[model samples]
Target: MKVVRSDWSRALLVCGKCSKKLDGGFGPKGRESLAKALRRHLGLEKGRRAAMGVIEVKCLGICPKRAVTVIDADDPHAWRLVDEGADLDAVVETLGLIRR
Candidate 1:
Protein backbone atom coordinates (compact mmCIF):
# COMPACT_ATOMS: atom_id res chain seq x y z
CA MET A 1 0.00 0.00 0.00
CA LYS A 2 1.18 3.47 -0.81
CA VAL A 3 1.03 5.98 2.00
CA VAL A 4 1.35 9.72 1.57
CA ARG A 5 2.82 11.91 4.30
CA SER A 6 1.06 15.10 5.37
CA ASP A 7 1.58 17.96 7.81
CA TRP A 8 -2.07 18.12 8.79
CA SER A 9 -2.84 17.91 12.50
CA ARG A 10 -6.52 17.40 11.73
CA ALA A 11 -9.11 17.74 9.01
CA LEU A 12 -12.31 19.70 8.57
CA LEU A 13 -15.21 18.52 6.47
CA VAL A 14 -17.42 21.23 5.00
CA CYS A 15 -20.72 20.41 3.37
CA GLY A 16 -20.63 21.34 -0.31
CA LYS A 17 -24.39 21.05 -0.65
CA CYS A 18 -24.99 23.50 2.15
CA SER A 19 -22.37 25.88 0.78
CA LYS A 20 -23.97 25.73 -2.65
CA LYS A 21 -27.39 26.31 -1.13
CA LEU A 22 -26.17 29.53 0.44
CA ASP A 23 -24.36 30.50 -2.77
CA GLY A 24 -21.07 31.97 -1.52
CA GLY A 25 -22.20 33.54 1.74
CA PHE A 26 -18.82 33.46 3.45
CA GLY A 27 -15.52 35.49 3.39
CA PRO A 28 -14.87 39.26 3.43
CA LYS A 29 -17.19 40.21 0.58
CA GLY A 30 -19.48 37.27 1.31
CA ARG A 31 -18.58 35.72 -2.02
CA GLU A 32 -16.55 32.66 -1.04
CA SER A 33 -17.40 29.14 0.00
CA LEU A 34 -16.93 28.08 3.58
CA ALA A 35 -13.96 25.87 2.76
CA LYS A 36 -12.30 28.54 0.68
CA ALA A 37 -12.98 31.25 3.21
CA LEU A 38 -11.67 29.18 6.07
CA ARG A 39 -8.56 28.26 4.14
CA ARG A 40 -7.85 31.88 3.39
CA HIS A 41 -8.61 32.95 6.95
CA LEU A 42 -6.23 30.33 8.33
CA GLY A 43 -3.51 31.08 5.78
CA LEU A 44 -3.55 27.50 4.65
CA GLU A 45 -2.55 26.05 1.33
CA LYS A 46 -4.66 23.57 -0.56
CA GLY A 47 -4.31 19.85 0.26
CA ARG A 48 -2.49 17.95 3.02
CA ARG A 49 0.56 20.15 3.22
CA ALA A 50 -1.42 22.69 5.26
CA ALA A 51 -1.40 22.69 9.04
CA MET A 52 -5.02 21.58 8.87
CA GLY A 53 -7.22 20.39 6.07
CA VAL A 54 -10.42 22.10 5.04
CA ILE A 55 -12.11 19.87 2.53
CA GLU A 56 -15.49 20.26 0.89
CA VAL A 57 -17.66 17.20 0.66
CA LYS A 58 -21.19 16.40 -0.42
CA CYS A 59 -24.38 16.72 1.69
CA LEU A 60 -24.11 16.14 5.43
CA GLY A 61 -27.96 16.04 5.77
CA ILE A 62 -28.43 18.80 8.40
CA CYS A 63 -29.26 21.49 5.77
CA PRO A 64 -29.86 24.41 8.09
CA LYS A 65 -31.27 27.60 6.63
CA ARG A 66 -28.59 30.19 5.76
CA ALA A 67 -25.91 27.99 7.30
CA VAL A 68 -23.26 25.44 6.39
CA THR A 69 -22.36 22.26 8.26
CA VAL A 70 -18.76 21.71 9.36
CA ILE A 71 -17.07 18.74 10.99
CA ASP A 72 -13.76 18.89 12.80
CA ALA A 73 -11.91 15.61 12.87
CA ASP A 74 -10.32 16.34 16.23
CA ASP A 75 -13.72 16.83 17.86
CA PRO A 76 -16.34 14.96 15.90
CA HIS A 77 -18.79 14.65 18.77
CA ALA A 78 -20.38 18.03 18.06
CA TRP A 79 -20.67 19.38 14.54
CA ARG A 80 -20.90 23.07 13.75
CA LEU A 81 -23.62 24.91 11.83
CA VAL A 82 -21.95 28.12 10.64
CA ASP A 83 -24.28 30.91 9.65
CA GLU A 84 -23.78 32.92 6.48
CA GLY A 85 -21.01 35.52 6.77
CA ALA A 86 -20.11 34.18 10.20
CA ASP A 87 -16.86 35.28 11.77
CA LEU A 88 -13.97 33.11 10.63
CA ASP A 89 -11.96 33.93 13.73
CA ALA A 90 -14.70 32.63 15.98
CA VAL A 91 -15.08 29.55 13.88
CA VAL A 92 -11.34 28.88 13.97
CA GLU A 93 -11.26 29.36 17.71
CA THR A 94 -14.25 27.08 18.24
CA LEU A 95 -12.69 24.40 16.07
CA GLY A 96 -9.37 24.68 17.90
CA LEU A 97 -7.55 25.30 14.65
CA ILE A 98 -5.17 27.91 16.01
CA ARG A 99 -1.55 26.96 15.60
CA ARG A 100 0.34 26.36 18.81
Candidate 2:
Protein backbone atom coordinates (compact mmCIF):
# COMPACT_ATOMS: atom_id res chain seq x y z
CA MET A 1 0.00 0.00 0.00
CA LYS A 2 1.18 3.47 -0.79
CA VAL A 3 1.53 5.71 2.23
CA VAL A 4 0.84 9.34 1.47
CA ARG A 5 2.15 11.77 4.01
CA SER A 6 1.62 15.49 4.54
CA ASP A 7 2.76 18.32 6.75
CA TRP A 8 -0.72 19.28 7.80
CA SER A 9 -0.94 19.62 11.56
CA ARG A 10 -4.71 19.68 11.62
CA ALA A 11 -7.26 17.43 9.96
CA LEU A 12 -10.97 18.17 9.96
CA LEU A 13 -13.52 15.56 9.00
CA VAL A 14 -16.81 17.10 7.94
CA CYS A 15 -19.99 15.04 7.87
CA GLY A 16 -21.10 14.46 4.27
CA LYS A 17 -24.58 13.37 5.24
CA CYS A 18 -25.18 16.47 7.29
CA SER A 19 -23.69 18.74 4.67
CA LYS A 20 -25.93 17.23 2.06
CA LYS A 21 -28.95 17.62 4.31
CA LEU A 22 -28.37 21.34 4.52
CA ASP A 23 -27.84 21.50 0.75
CA GLY A 24 -25.40 24.37 0.49
CA GLY A 25 -26.63 26.22 3.53
CA PHE A 26 -23.33 28.02 4.00
CA GLY A 27 -21.34 30.78 2.22
CA PRO A 28 -22.83 33.85 0.61
CA LYS A 29 -26.53 33.62 -0.23
CA GLY A 30 -26.42 30.33 1.71
CA ARG A 31 -25.24 28.33 -1.26
CA GLU A 32 -22.31 26.27 0.00
CA SER A 33 -21.78 23.34 2.28
CA LEU A 34 -19.69 23.54 5.41
CA ALA A 35 -16.66 21.84 3.85
CA LYS A 36 -16.78 23.82 0.62
CA ALA A 37 -17.44 27.07 2.40
CA LEU A 38 -14.60 26.53 4.87
CA ARG A 39 -12.17 25.69 2.10
CA ARG A 40 -13.13 28.75 0.09
CA HIS A 41 -13.02 30.96 3.16
CA LEU A 42 -9.58 29.70 4.14
CA GLY A 43 -8.23 29.73 0.59
CA LEU A 44 -7.11 26.15 1.04
CA GLU A 45 -6.16 23.74 -1.69
CA LYS A 46 -7.85 20.41 -2.24
CA GLY A 47 -5.05 18.16 -0.99
CA ARG A 48 -2.20 20.30 0.25
CA ARG A 49 -3.42 23.47 1.86
CA ALA A 50 -0.97 24.85 4.37
CA ALA A 51 -0.71 22.68 7.48
CA MET A 52 -4.35 21.75 7.64
CA GLY A 53 -6.47 19.02 6.11
CA VAL A 54 -10.19 19.40 5.58
CA ILE A 55 -11.82 16.31 4.17
CA GLU A 56 -15.41 15.21 3.93
CA VAL A 57 -16.22 11.75 5.17
CA LYS A 58 -19.23 9.48 5.40
CA CYS A 59 -22.06 10.09 7.83
CA LEU A 60 -20.90 10.61 11.43
CA GLY A 61 -24.22 9.38 12.79
CA ILE A 62 -24.93 12.64 14.60
CA CYS A 63 -27.45 14.29 12.32
CA PRO A 64 -28.32 17.57 13.93
CA LYS A 65 -31.26 19.70 13.01
CA ARG A 66 -30.25 21.99 10.14
CA ALA A 67 -26.56 21.71 10.95
CA VAL A 68 -23.43 19.68 10.29
CA THR A 69 -21.34 17.70 12.74
CA VAL A 70 -17.58 18.19 12.51
CA ILE A 71 -14.83 16.10 14.02
CA ASP A 72 -11.52 17.75 14.59
CA ALA A 73 -8.74 15.26 14.23
CA ASP A 74 -6.66 17.27 16.61
CA ASP A 75 -9.19 16.86 19.35
CA PRO A 76 -11.66 14.06 18.96
CA HIS A 77 -12.92 14.38 22.51
CA ALA A 78 -15.12 17.26 21.50
CA TRP A 79 -17.33 17.52 18.42
CA ARG A 80 -18.70 20.63 16.83
CA LEU A 81 -22.14 21.39 15.50
CA VAL A 82 -21.81 24.06 12.87
CA ASP A 83 -24.82 25.89 11.57
CA GLU A 84 -25.02 27.05 7.97
CA GLY A 85 -23.82 30.58 7.28
CA ALA A 86 -22.39 30.80 10.77
CA ASP A 87 -19.23 32.89 10.39
CA LEU A 88 -16.48 30.70 8.98
CA ASP A 89 -13.81 32.77 10.63
CA ALA A 90 -15.34 32.20 14.01
CA VAL A 91 -15.50 28.49 13.39
CA VAL A 92 -11.81 28.32 12.53
CA GLU A 93 -10.90 30.31 15.57
CA THR A 94 -13.13 28.28 17.86
CA LEU A 95 -11.66 25.06 16.59
CA GLY A 96 -8.13 26.38 16.95
CA LEU A 97 -7.47 25.20 13.44
CA ILE A 98 -6.13 28.54 12.24
CA ARG A 99 -5.69 32.15 13.18
CA ARG A 100 -7.45 34.83 11.17
- Give the best candidate by lDDT: 1
**Residue 9, candidate 2: alpha-carbon lDDT:** 77
Each candidate: RMSD: 1.4, 1.7
Model 1 regions more than 4 Å off = none
- lDDT string, candidate 1, 31-77, tens digits: 89999999888888998888888999999989999999999887889
**Residue 19 in candidate 1, Cα distance off native in Å:** 0.8
- Range of the 10 consecutive residues with the lowest summed lDDT in candidate 2: 43-52
Strongest candidate by TM-score? 1
State the TM-score for model 2. Answer: 0.89
Model 1 — which ten-residue stretch has the worst lDDT? Answer: 91-100
Evaluate all candidate structures by whole-model CA lDDT and list the values in order: 0.89, 0.84
For candidate 2, write residues 1-100 as lDDT tens digits: 9977786778899998888888878988887889888888877777864557788999998889988999998789999999867888899889876643
